[model samples]
Target: MLTILPPSFTLTDDSLQELLLSSSSSSKSWSAREEACYLIFFSGTLPVLPGSHTASIAGQKEEEEEEEEEAQGDPLSESQLTSLKEGLWCPDCRAALLAVLSIFSPGSLAATTASSTSTSTSTTTGAASAVEARALLLQVSREQWKDRTDGGHVYRKRYDVQSVPTVLKWIGGKEVGRLVDEECADVDKIRALVQG
Candidate 1:
């Protein structure tokens, strides 16, 4: 329900400069641009209003739910839906993609983010993980995420990312440590993620 971003084509518009005052932080500007990307995926949608009870979702997740039959997109098998739960809230595919977007802070790493192009185009590719991460999140509703045939399955196999909100500490290209799920939400654990 938050689709307020202007089209990406407007991102470079010279006329829009009038909206910025000198004190505005560049970070805020970047964050604004990023919102446009969130719109590209429907991850910005709130299934039920925030701070309310969680509801079941049916289609196009990074996602929310109600009325599985009324949910948009193709239906997932019970077994398949169960598999997706590890990485997504309610195992919605849309959540899978949103999880990836949540991974690193802007400029936090000299990182490569594999981004799928818009439909009917070639998805961005480079690092094996980039492409893998993109595919996993983009096609949550289209395939069995943990199945051998799913590319995300392959990516997770390499990193051992079995669930959502996993934080990996990669030092010099080798994984030094990791914090999974609830551990990531703890203040002390987050400090330890970098310190211990």
Candidate 2:
């Protein structure tokens, strides 16, 4: 069994790319331990979407009229909300993976992230819109990706990757160019690695 390790930094396209390149140079495949870590870490950062609820239909005039006639009232239960937050309202791991992979799917990451942010904010006030939520989420996201870097931690670590974008760019080769082009990742370390 492989023990997965958290990324030394955020799992950006650049970092993933760099790992791939390094592995390729070393004659290794994506199945390598570090590569597996990247894959697992990437898989976990995916966003969960809320599902349809009684409140959702309540917003519709037709459903409102129908409900009024029936005197029916059952809002989304707290458990349902919890389940939605888990991204487990339904079991669609493939779809979820696709969503995560969409980060590399030309123009899809921005669109999906935007839509996700908007949806999350719809339940809150204007102060909690996608624009604001993204900023907060991005910050939290970065923190989550941060490795434990106390004094002298860098030398203790064998592979010293610091940023997701940087790693992605280094190992991405040609496939991750979309991420680089989108300005979501960078790859300057390849030169450094080569020079050193």
Candidate 3:
């Protein structure tokens, strides 16, 4: 099976671009495709919305609402207030990280063959998805594509990325595909974009 290692983290687009450029042969952009492709991803997220209860139990949704009201009735604890002030509740962002990590959880890239084949042409959609998550590491220059909170980040402004858990696929130093916000939470979608 062909597999790529997970991405390596970088703080700047120039540094990341440089790493991707040199990632393969000085001549290649580093991809499973004959042409070489690279990926940059961002997983940072803002806090959840006020009306969130996406996972609230059916019967307990009302109870939770009541609890929220009750909690408001009481004075807020210092820690509770602090948590409210600084907490980030974006489960999708966490899920995105977990989905990718889950692909790696079974085994490290070092445990696999150094070189292999790509899954972009697998038999079934499901099979292709399963393999591509791992293929993501091998198919592209393995620079970790995580997001940053710096509003002034280079690519952040350039790409106009407004959500967390974003993924960008680049070939020849140009972006070819992207997944923003919750889309990045699905390993299948992530792999599809990279593998596509």
Top of the candidates by TM-score: 3
lDDT of 2 by residue, 18-130 (tens): 54444344554433423212222221232212211111112364753454444223323334333433642222322232222222221222333424433222222222121
- The number of the candidate with the highest lDDT is 3
Model 1: how large is the Cα RMSD against the reference?
Answer: 17.0
Candidate 2: stretches off by over 4 Å: 1-44, 48-103, 107-156, 169-196
CA-only RMSD, every prediction: 17.0, 17.3, 17.2
lDDT for each residue of candidate 1 in 1-196, tens digit (9 for 90 to 100): 1111211212122222222212134434422442211111111222221111122223433333342224333323334333434533333333332223222111111222223211112322222122211001112222333365545653356556665445555432345666565554343343344445
Better of 2 and 3 by TM-score: 3
lDDT against the true structure, per candidate, is 0.30, 0.27, 0.39
For each candidate, give its TM-score against the true structure: 0.30, 0.22, 0.43
| Model 2 residue 196 distance off true place after TM-score fit, in angstroms | 19
In model 2, the worst 10-residue window by lDDT is 130-139
lDDT of model 2 at residue 95? Answer: 28
User: Clashes in model 1: which pairs?
Assistant: 56-65, 57-65, 61-94, 62-94, 62-95
The deviation in Å at residue 34 for candidate 3 is 6.3
lDDT at position 51, candidate 2: 16
For candidate 2, the clash count comes to: 10
